[model samples]
Target: MNCRRLNIINRNSQRLLFLVNQLLDFKKVEQNGFTVQFSRQNVTNLVTAVAERFAPSIEQMGGKLVVEQCERDIEADVDAEALTKLVSNLLNNARKYMKDRIVIACHADEGQGWFTISVSDNGVGISRDNQEKIFKPFFQVMDDNRESKGGTGLGLSIVQSVVEAHKGEIKVESSLGNGATFIVTLPLRQEGVTASAGNDIMSPAEDKGCSRAIDGGVNDVSRPVMLIVDDNEEMLQFITSNFNSDYEVVTAVNGKEALDKLSRHEVALIVSDWMMPVMNGVELCRAVRSNCNYSHIPFILLTAKTDNYSKIEGLNCGADAYVEKPFSVNYLEARIHNLVEMRKLLREKFSQTPLEPINTIAPNPVDDQFLTQLTNIIEENFSNPELSVDFLANRMGISRSGLYAKIKTLANVTPNELIQLTRLKKAAKLLAENKYRINEICYMVGFNSSSYFSKCFQRQFGIKPGEFTPHSL
Candidate 1:
């Protein structure tokens, strides 16, 4: 075959593949939902790259690619990857439908905290009736001599989705005989701490340092630690800014990174993105649950995947909460505080509650057996005031660390907590039966101090032992 003819065939194949890729990309956004990870980016450089990429192709089709003399380097909080795709899709539509030339332009209005990008083509324009439906997925325009063309109608739909993900707007200005211009306007930054304005310019790689320590500041060991996981750097910074006052915020780019951080840090809670490059949130949740040390940490998955199936899967994977993207900052702060408080309550409850009797208490059979054996040993040593982790470890034929790992994995509570919980349950039962006075019950259940017993009981069940009579029980 002639080389020119073969090249033409190759071009067609590339276009088909492009369509397939676009379809897959859009489907993922639709099914899993999308969260725009924002950062400071040069809109001009991004658009220029896209234009240069297709310039040769446009030239081959008897057209020229012109980047207009608009604000060339507008820097703002934008998801560069999504913006790249959006601009590429618009360029592709222009290449396919109208024009001897394609033009790209951008403007930034910092006063209004907004920015805009417009792509125009002088090709065969769209009719007013058709313009209304152009951005709908797979809606191709019909025109004179429109036959013998290969195109996926997904281009504009993808453009629209990207715009919406950034909390932006998109519209078309066109007439049948006139040309078409697709313009996109986006906020320079989202309002208040759910997202922070990034730097004036950025590279493809993000700084991973912000999550652990910022500006090389010494680590504050006194503050409670929180793990913020999201692929977007701006979001991580934003979340950190909001939580830094109350908690020591550490950042991670994805689930895998978060897991690595957990291996090293005593994180109190985790807020993660559902979809990310390395490992997504659900996988991280499952991994965290399976781990002995990290299982007890509260997990909140912040994602755009709000579909029922996705939400259920996230919850099933061990996420304590599911927060959708474009989420309210107030709601997120409240939710985080709530999860932390709930976690404290849960651990206290685990320390006090009976873990045996699978049908009644334990959820899994393995846990039931483990708890049954552990509780039996506790009962055997119930009267010993010297009962401690070292004593329990020796009795169980495991090291202290091994015991901690086992109990944490099983009940998301420490072995010491389990022992305390066992004793509390015994004391509560004795009190409920009115078989012993509060002092006697405390000593009998291995508690040295009746006052301490009262405090623990109040914390576990919201009632003082003296006030929690048989009738109350």
Candidate 2:
């Protein structure tokens, strides 16, 4: 068959398979007394079933399926039907694209109550540019090739959605020609929620209601109060839109205006462009620091210039962090979260010990050591986009559980939380200085998406970054 015809067939097959699985899940849900039952299943068994189901096709394509068993049982609490579909889609993709042997490895740690199910193949792996897009719906890395291979470009996206529904995380490790490994980690069971009661199967509307309720309360507590300092009206509106959620955003076009707003209302954070007509980010930071009342408020400098000297100059002028232009929203959100957490801690400590200096050392040396090591590790990998808890644990030669425990004991935050905080602090400095475009600043701080970044940034700052201009106060 021609590539196009084959692709059409593949798409049809995938859709058919998805429909069948959905029906099966629905049936299973009905049979299981309408309770969401999270059960522990073996990864090896799951992969074997999926591979066997696709054996005929694999054999026709002249490929072999290889299963690798780790020393432990790879177990997770998942809806059996959904989990099965996730595995099947991954394996199906591997078999269709690969010319040789496909390997499925199961790694589990009973102590940690987690597992990583990885399906890999000697096929043409995903390119770096296409990696992120792959999880997005209807985004196929190779449209022409995939057409011939018969893919609807929805397999990975479905996999992602299903995994997220199960409250798990999925990641891809791939490079062109090297092979691709899709790893999924899920909890053995939902913590605090009993499996005996079954999974709480809620309708879409009910789920939305629950989410709204949760978000409503969170919005009240975590709403960001942003102070924007920019001279451009268009830029101010653009920045404000990026952070309206989770923020009571305010705006000013210049330093004086920002300072005036600051005086009138309490702002959690400041996002300022570096080059402004009347008073810039550097000038603003200087002004804020000079004022005894506002010196403690976090400041971020956003600039288009990605020079070492410029960054240093901004930092020296009391900017907490710096971000270059053309940044990702994900990076900016992470940075903002970090700064906000720091400010919260500082405020709490300041309130508790009014007479004491804020710089008092941590009481525990063990915690101090761990924090130092963590800080060093974070600094070393500050530029890495995938620098997360998993990455940190792998780098530190510790298990995820161990890393979490150590971080919680030493830093008073989870490893993931710490990473987010670190990134947020860095982004805050750039925003306060206002040197770069908001989008540019987001990615420069290592966030993958600007919308997500703004949400996070607003959560930390109590206002949108666009409204926290030095001139406003």
Candidate 3:
């Protein structure tokens, strides 16, 4: 084909694909709900309809599209449009790039409460290097060469996003010269899930669960106010965006302003920076803790300080948590959720408690000594991921086994767990105050994955990180 003819063909093809993709995308979004109507017949008809639509395209590309037969009809609680888009994207990719044959398969196991639909293509396979990048937005490996097909590069990204939105996962397996296979797994619809009508697909119960998870059950009217302290405009904007959805977020530029805000407002949580002028986080924490009125309110310190001494000092100075810098949005959100939940729960507990007579509480001398020593160790090597039992023991001139035993005896937990717990708790506070995202919070707290950070948060608090933020209140 001439250059002009090829260009014309490419444009026409892209336009057609774009229209089809948009229609499918719209359908998925529109039909997604807690209860969707799909019987075995419906699934079959839908699959057949999609296959027929793509068959001509596949034939034009000299590729055969084969649909593998399953033993029984598969009915799933899924948006048909979403599923169709996923399947169609996979098929289109295979047909466009694959060398010869494409296989589309669906499997249903009612006993397992899960169904899987997969598309396998025998084409010029994707390299390992490009597999992960393929799902990212506007990323195309085959750019403008003759062999390079036409696409806007949004297909796979959209597919992944839609799947994740539906609470599902997409997995890809490919090797250079070996074709790629894409698998999508979804929850099978049984009688348990309520089927609801309207474009708002999630059931009332699911919505409640999501709301409860993202926002702690603080009544909107009674939710404690929060004051955010940050100097960077971008950081402040990001923080505000994350919290404005649920909380009445107020921002301050520095510790001095933070104190000023606290004086004027009944702030439930104070999130301040460690490096701010006029007063740093330690100074702010000390100031707040010293005052009887603000002492009860939880204080969270955000800083780039990874040193153990810094964290310990912040915690010791009445800061509820100390989140480190360079955190993820999700991790930060999770942490915020955690602190909010804790604050709400504590408020409830305190409200229910009978007033106690004034009494002097003695400080534990042993705890002070231990905390001092721990601070020294953490300060010495906060950057070391393996700064755990072996490292601490080595530093203290003791054996690994002995150090582990001693730490357990003193702290009632493993040394590593304690360290991680401390890091996560601090991270959670930063998150609740909308200081960072989950991923940033993960790194800030010395974690590698937002998912891992979330798991750790759940383990520590018996709730997901998202549930810590007060949504209603």
Candidate 4:
């Protein structure tokens, strides 16, 4: 048999196995005997592996499956076997209803203390009324012809049970024509935690400790831009007024509008409401984190949702912090200041050690990958005197201005300065090796004039090249 045909058979067998397991899980759920065996496991690795299993089959069906993996693995106390089944069922259902693409995103919010996994697909969407019913046992949304697609309809039902058993919650967002997104949020650690269906598992008091009141002085001129989004005009103005003295406050009524503002302005931070028309804060957070341009911006989600699951959902989508509604203005302002200052400190660290590993600071995966690629390119071409910022930008597949901005934000240095630093570091290494004279090493590392190289080296290292020793690094 051909490979494609064999792959189909393999996929069918896996589906059949899952169906059998689903029926067994349904029985367990009905009998209330489905006890989760919780142990600490790396959730990111497990979820990524499960998502990969459906890729070949989805591709065979002329569909695409995109799995967004995190840079850092999230270790959580979970029933590994049950979580595997939960993800498998989600992928299977997406495969059934998806038109051409399915996206799976996984993130862990240490700040909010939740691990989140979301499965989305572009296909026939679910209506608001049916959204609640779709999780019921043996429930399926029939087509216009009043025919079921296929399955016992126990997949999502079992998924919900697994989530509840793990003291987590599953939520679905969809409409008639738009696609659907299923978000499953679980605690980072399941210990001494008791929860029942529809119960608030955690108290807001547990989150109050995260609110730091450190003050970073604000400037009157050239203030950092802050985006405040809310559907309610009153709430929008309220937040804007509070931050007006500190930031160049811009207002948007929804996530779409917020994104429009992001494109037009260099936003320093974002504060948004949870519920709104067009798009909500969680969706906006996800969109911002998915794009490299805005991923590093500190996001603060303001919501009335006090439940543990809701907080996890918001933070897992990449909100740097969460503030419950009717929140203290002082607390909110403190958190905003804390997040901005923390990023500034991180940038300072990176600037001091530009050649350090990206994983050292544990930035988002997108930025980590970008910096890794960038450093590799620079290291490979550092000896080329013709290597310019524009050339590096082209190689990085970004505009010159974008590269300049990213490097400045990330490393607290311009692109040209970064390149020069990279060359100087290389020259430092060569000098430490005691393998060549200063002149030879200077020419070898792309410096044409020894006198100029000496000056730059002294400026960067606070000592002349000849004064550099192995311990100086």
lDDT agreement with native, every candidate: 0.72, 0.65, 0.62, 0.77
**Model 1 off-target regions past 4 Å?**
1-221, 344-376, 384-386, 393-421, 434-444, 447-468
TM-score of 1: 0.43
The digit string of per-residue lDDT tens for model 2 on 20-122 reads 5545554554465223446654555656556655655566689888878677555566666567668877897787668587888777667877777788888
Each candidate structure's TM-score, on Cα atoms with residue i matched to residue i, is 0.43, 0.35, 0.36, 0.49
Better of 2 and 3 by TM-score: 3
Where is model 4 more than 4 Å wrong at Cα?
1-221, 358-362, 429-437, 467-473
Q: Write the per-residue lDDT of candidate 1 for residues 1-473, one digit (tens) a residue.
A: 66577457646665666777788877887897666777666677677666766777788899988887663577777787788789889998888866698888888888988999998999779888888888887788876876624577888888888898899999999987678999999998754323332222333224221111101122223656889998765567556655664577888998888889987776777889887878998999888877645665678898877799998998888788899876655689889778655544544445434332312334334445556777888978988777788888887676777677556534555566667667777777787788778899888888788787787776655568887764563
RMSD of model 3 against the true structure? 23.4
Residues 1-473 of candidate 3 have per-residue lDDT tens digits of 46567446644754675656555554564466222344233455456557766765577678788888888777666666456666667777777778878888888777877778888887767888888799876677672253567666667877786576556778888886778899987767544343532223233433321121212222233434778887654456556654553456889888788888877776766777787667777887787766533554557788879998877887888776778765544566777779656545543332222121001110123333444566467544556767777777767665665545434323334556546545654665676687777778777766777787787666555567666663411
Put the candidates in lDDT order, highest first. 4, 1, 2, 3
Error of 1 at 257 (Å): 2.5
Model 4 TM-score is 0.49
